[model samples]
Target: MNEKLHCIGCGTEIQTENPQEPGYAPVSSLEKEDIICKRCFRLKNYNELQPVSLTDDDFLRILNGLGTQKGLIVKIVDIFDFNGSWLPGLHRFVGSNPVLLIANKVDLLPKSVNKNKVINWIKQEAKNLGLKPIDVLLVSAHKGSGMTEAMEAIEHYRRGEDVYVVGCTNVGKSTFINRIIKTATGTGDIITTSHFPGTTLDMIEIPLDDKKAIFDTPGIINHHQMAHYLDPSELKFIMPKKEIKPKTFQLNAGQTLFVGALARFDFIQGQRAAFTVHIANDLDIHRTKLEKADELYANHRGELLAPPSEKYIDQLPRLVRHEFSIKEAKTDIVFSGLGWITIQDTNCVIAAYAPEGVEVQVRPSLI
Candidate 1:
């Protein structure tokens, strides 16, 4: 009989068979006296991320236990994909605990974006989702910006209680925790950080003081996110690694824009106006006549218009149209996990298309 071993970082039972799943360690590493899994090793050494899966029931079960614990819930959200990153029924899991909302990835937005306006929008969106955050702090876990403010807020609100850091996958929760740990303890040691969902299978705790600790929980997987549909290689083209340089396109009433093969936007009845796009700076954007849009897509889906390459075409949901009639102010047509288009034409009608389950929303412009 063989003795079972577990990862010291996330506590998942270690195995060597699958590299894509959690608790994976190489055969050599598994023989060591003290070992961290390969996922945690990569995160600690290279700051890289990987994805893993967890059932909805497992996620709910972990969160449901939080209600019975006494702590401050620090819910991290990706500013770019708020709706897609939000964990549904989060309010039910926290009981009466106060939530400190930290909006991560502020560095990805353009410099012209107003922080105050963005914060206000985040508050409104969270409220609409039935989450009443005690304080909302915007920070970039990657750049180490606005983290001091987040720490101050956590110190003030936590008030000697244990803190549970929670969020959906890919929201930068693990990176944020690693930053906090490095800042507090003056150590480069990091908890596992991965782009994949379910990176943390069990709670990994770091002592905040002699009496209290901060626990990093596993990220709840959101199936609607494009991250779940796209391959790891394809994600680099969609997910922004650096600040986005907004691409402005002047389009007529009959023009259409294609964002790789992941999404499309049509100027149905809008005036000749500029539509500013905010997406990964590296993604290719193409413009064509609206009449030829369907034909172009049909011909070049996995070729000229890529991302849903030949291998992923069958897995991707069919594009569904969401018609919007802009009324007063500037509005953003958001395609979840991809990017958004900001338009300023009043009484203008536009149509945004994305995968069927992925959310396409209209909100007041952030810029």
Candidate 2:
């Protein structure tokens, strides 16, 4: 029998079949001195990320081991998808280690958005979620923004101990580590990065000093994210690449807005109000009468209202409604991972709808 080979990059056991699966390398590449899976190859050369599915058992095992390890836990979360990317109850798993929360993708927010306010919002959310980090800082790993401050903060907090970077899949943990590598050794893109989730399969350790190193752990998949239900091609529509240009729609009661057939916002019984949508600028949001919503979705889900685009409409889950009463003057209805709709008017009754498994909730505005 042939001895099993593994990808030098992601550490997945190599296989020649099924390009979609983890650890798939081309048959021709088998004889090469250094072999990497096809997924890592595309990520390195093209800067494209391919999606992979790993069992929950695999991620839980890694997370369960964090408490036993003596290191600083540097947790990264997507600023845009704050709640969706959060690893709930992580404070318990870290034991006595201090956590430094690094919020990635800050560049995606509008320039008008206040940085201090965002940081304060994150700190509050972290406390509410049972994580009391040593510090909360924002960074954009893709744009190389705030990396210097992040590095300084990490070094200061780690105190000669090792660092473990953890976050859910697609939170840019790999890209952030790549930035650290480039800054430290001038190496370019050592870890594979893509827009899709589950890019890293194993814990990759980078030496911080002779005695300590930073470990990039596999991203624990957040099952509640909207990204799981859509096809790879459709991800571009939801994942914002540029600063979000807040889109505000003036609507009266009984109006329905569709966020690419992935989420729905209805002004059920509200006075005239302006709902500012903070989503990927490229995503289409169509407004129609509430009475016509059912007919319109039934007719146009895969077409006019997309991203369960015609290709994957059948696989998409049914929309589940979660209604909220707007008590605060400035409130956000978050459609976890997709984006949010901020309603600045009080005493309004509204309903947010998202795919059955996807999460939708109300919170104070981030901006």
Candidate 3:
């Protein structure tokens, strides 16, 4: 028929070649009764993960167009990886549109953590970035936590206007919207959800009412995310699906901890102190002497350290060091998309190492 077809799951145009790209289906599959791209097909049937390929310019173009459209912006962010999930210059693209910050994956936080404190911290961080959200709500899209509050906030702020949901890739926007759809319509149909970036290539709209609609925008591609570097099987080891049980290590000077061979935390000049790590429970962590850390990593990265899988080892960037000296309050050394370590020690000198371009930030402790 030579007719153009789009995947109903994510709205990406279907093609036969380029399996790495979005909306790719086999020629045989295209001739079938129900046409879905390989990404959607695997996600729906086998529950497999695939990377989404979209350029930074493409995401910026989609976001820039929102400035001219009249709608409420619902910015969904992964609570576990806040910095990695946040789109840079979000305020500039929205052009004064009221933003409702929806922090997804709140269920992943430790049970001992206070929600109010986390919300305040998120607000402060947004304020520092010049993003003044009209409201902030924490929700676990995967578990249906806080979906009602999110809906109420959207309804209240949207005021019968269109609602635009946006965020960086792997932020769980599709899952969040799917929950909203099911909640509002009592339908079991779900939009495709995957750990990979660029899952949504075009906008998918759900009618909220005759006068209003909620739009799910494609996730903005951020090159700085660790997800871009790891294989799909490795993602489960790093991406926390449950509450993170804090792992504390008592370290003396000249010690190092390897976070799955992807990051290193060195106790350069710290006194005998405790460092609390918050990362996926399944990921392996190894401790060794700082002097021999490099030798160990080079010798047995994929075997002992892991997740720079053998296939991706050559493509992984060299570890770049970021040194920090903490003299005051507790601080979190965040490795974007990986997790963070919180340390509270006076006159402590430490250093964090991660693949080049993956952000390693030092921020005031949220706990």
Candidate 4:
């Protein structure tokens, strides 16, 4: 009896069963030859990249296994999406390991933005989440910004100890790891790439020195991130560029601004100083009176005030609002995956709303 086979990449027939042959489908996917496995076609085309996925169970097991090992945690997080970019139970996994937080994507902020303030914000957020990072380093894995500071801090903090890099999915953990790899070994073969979810599952280790090395762990799934709902092109709309241009708007009380459905800020009361927005250049920011915010959101939500496409809105969990009253210098009110609002020195209360599972926070304004 002959069986059928298929490729996972571009569904097609498998002409041969040789282990190394093209169009080779896993035994599990063999039932449907018309549905070619991606691996086969990717190898055949030699143009695309293959992604590795880790199951939730496998992910937990790996984290648990790390307990028996020794290392310092270098938690990498996306600055634009700080709230949604944390490890949920990392403290438990790394117990007293002395973690150092690396806030990636600093290049996405305004050129004049104060980086120290962003670092301070990361510390504050870490404190709020019951995480105690000995230090926080700002970096841009893509543009290599802050890489030196981050590497120096890691070297100092680790102090001959192993380093473990962890973060939620889409926070650029892999790229950050690649940057470290390039600097440490002058190569980029250490990490993998992908567009879908659950890219890294097992812990891939890289030796920093002969005895002391670092570990690169896969990213955990963050369901609430706006990126999950967006297509690749759409996602680019939110991911910041190498350089960011802050958009400043002067407004009085009763004004609202939308930062891609990932965040909505309603300026209710205060002497409005200019609210500068630092977000993905492609992401749109619209302003309106606070009174008409709800109406405007309801009317133009998925469209003008997009991100939560009608499908995303219907499937997405309810949005929860976090109220913050700012009374001070420049402050960054961060909506994970969305963008941040720079509240100038002044007293004002603002309410930000995001999907249920996402995290929203405020940091000392870096600008």
Candidate 5:
């Protein structure tokens, strides 16, 4: 019989019998110092599943403290799901402090798109959203790509300052911090990085020797995120990952598309607009004519449409619609959690949908 221990990642006590939760370890490995077992280890090292949710109040309390400190604020963003991973009201929370934005998951973009261009675009986009970040670095937190550069940036700006890593849940925030831990310090720290979702429920500070330290806060779980309503099996089908090969569908007015039950997009006006979808590479996307979409969705939501499965179906609200005209330069009809439909710089009427209570807003297109 194997004894159990708490997981190094989430500090959850383990039973070893149930492999479903974090911290599952055997008696031999249970007492190990860095006892993060296979489950948490995979989630931390690879981009594996460790779904945990946090509340808004808990998230805001952590942010409010950042302004009082004198450290570099490293704001992280998901390159694959940029819109979904950005925290709203972040600018107000950080105050006048200098901010460095790191667009994480760079490995997930199109090969043709220049990496520098994407970083620049994110920098500009951040400003338009009222956040004047001091610098922006692109990195693939999963593969340790550009992590050194990000560290250099953090070190240069840190100036013996406290560091705050900010990102919405699932933007590789924990992974990036772990990288920061390994490179900046070494592999000897006791409280190391392993993914178990928002590991730092409160602000967990790791000292940079005696003078400086990195403060990691619990990831702010967007109440609007699909992850909250989704099971582990469902998220893989909905979220996009690497180099989003934009799925394009020519839609006549009154056509509907479902982004794995996370969002519904309907073409309401204009001459057959080109609907460009950006999502995780793994998720299944289904489309049908508006007249039949509702019926199809009802019949095949869990089987075909997926994500918000029948188990969580009743939890999902009736999809609400927001009608808007793309009057600005290349506006993206941002859907919470799923991804966005890039509307080219043209005037067109579009209707967007998500489960009720999740706020959806359009921003300048990234591409």
Candidate 6:
């Protein structure tokens, strides 16, 4: 049993013990010519992922190494959770390498949403966050939309140099790389794709025609993600699978809308206006008076409100409120990884809430 041996599926060093950890394989499987760890095995066959995480130190070491290497950085992000999936300060870590931003999961957005507007917004947000990317493109890695364009962009920007694909956990970095493998080598599923964070344990490289390579780096887990605060079973309810149908609620001041038990949006001060919710359609939304919101949530957070489902309710931190005064028209109140609510009317006061560590902020309407 050589501890140095890595899983062919995820590149984590193989170990016989600790099934709960990465690279866990049965001793019986050691004789096989190509052995994937238990995690990848389940993902490949059952399409079910068991959640696992890596230490920040582990990812920091990987990212810091990028600064010393020469390559084009291909940064993937979830369009539905752009801020949550973003690797903050990535520009400083990649040295002078040009970053090509790939915003994945475009298929989950509403059909009415303008693609160019989304691209522009992403570019502005990248600049605001100190990342000046060479280009920004949107694609649905799962559905293959804009993937050809994405591939072309990578080829053009890399310019015979190595390419490094990086992003926070659950942003479809692995899926994006799998698409490349399928196209380049006519082989697929070389890497594991899962809902779990830190699916890729180590850097896996794919050789280009010119002997250059594209490296798939391990996903850095963002603590502020709503995924970290919910049970895996609840993840499906929050992570949208199909195109979203914008649900608009007409409300006056002093009304509250609960997006499952994961987030809350309150119209504190505004004229009667339309509040359009852009979230996973499977997740339930409950509207109530602002005054009764506190009492309702306190009484039925895991039941009537749903999601944490009582069994895992204690795992979530207490909700923390973030207030905003919307001066700009069509402002969106984003609940990090969960989703967002758009306010079309200006001069409105709003308050959003999420689990203590999760982020809630306002931005220009993405649609």
Model 6: per-residue Cα lDDT over 1-367, one tens digit each? 6447787777678898887567899999998989888877865664434444567877777677788778899999998888888888788899988999999999988988888888888889899899999999999999999999999999999988988888888898868877787787654344333222333364556668897878777667898888888887888889988898899999999999988788888899978999999998888999999999999999999999989899988898999999988888898888888888999888999899999978777778877
Sort order, TM-score high to low = 1, 2, 6, 3, 5, 4
Cα miss at 274, model 3 (Å)? 0.8
Q: Which stretches of candidate 4 lie over 4 Å from their true place?
A: 1-53, 148-161, 183-201, 208-213, 308-313
Better of 2 and 5 by TM-score: 2
CA lDDT, every model vs. true structure? 0.83, 0.83, 0.81, 0.68, 0.70, 0.83
User: Is candidate 1 or 3 superior in lDDT?
Assistant: 1
3 against 5, candidate with superior lDDT? 3
- Please give, for residues 158-276, the per-residue lDDT of candidate 5 as tens digits: 87777887787788887887676566555443434423233334344566765677767666777556565667666776665556787777778888888776788888777766778
How many residue pairs clash per model? Answer: 4, 1, 0, 15, 8, 0
Q: Name the Cα RMSD for model 2.
A: 4.1
Where model 5 places Cα greater than 4 Å from the true spot, the runs are 1-57, 114-117, 190-204, 327-331
What's the TM-score of every candidate structure?
A: 0.90, 0.89, 0.88, 0.75, 0.76, 0.89
Clashing pairs in 2: 49-194
Please give, for residues 1-367, the per-residue lDDT of candidate 2 as tens digits.
1988988777778999877667888899999988998867865665444545556776666677788788899999998888888878788889899999999999988887889988988898899889898999999999999999999998999998988888888899868977786676454354432121233365555667655877767667888777778787888889999999999999999999999889999999978998999999889999999999999999999999987788889888999999888878789898888888999888999999999988787778877
Could you give the C-alpha RMSD of every candidate to the true structure, in order shown? 3.7, 4.1, 4.4, 6.6, 5.4, 4.2
Candidate 5 pairs with clashing backbones? 108-243, 237-283, 239-280, 240-279, 240-280, 240-281, 241-280, 241-281
Q: Across residues 287-347, which tens digit of lDDT does each residue of candidate 1 receive?
A: 9999999999988898788887888777778899999888855789999888899996677
Give the poorly placed runs of model 1, Cα more than 4 Å off: 1-11, 31-36, 39-53, 188-200
lDDT for predicted candidate 4 compared with the true structure: 0.68
User: Where does candidate 2 stray beyond 4 Å?
Assistant: 1-3, 7-11, 18-21, 32-53, 187-202
Q: Single out the weakest 10-residue window by summed lDDT for candidate 5.
A: 193-202
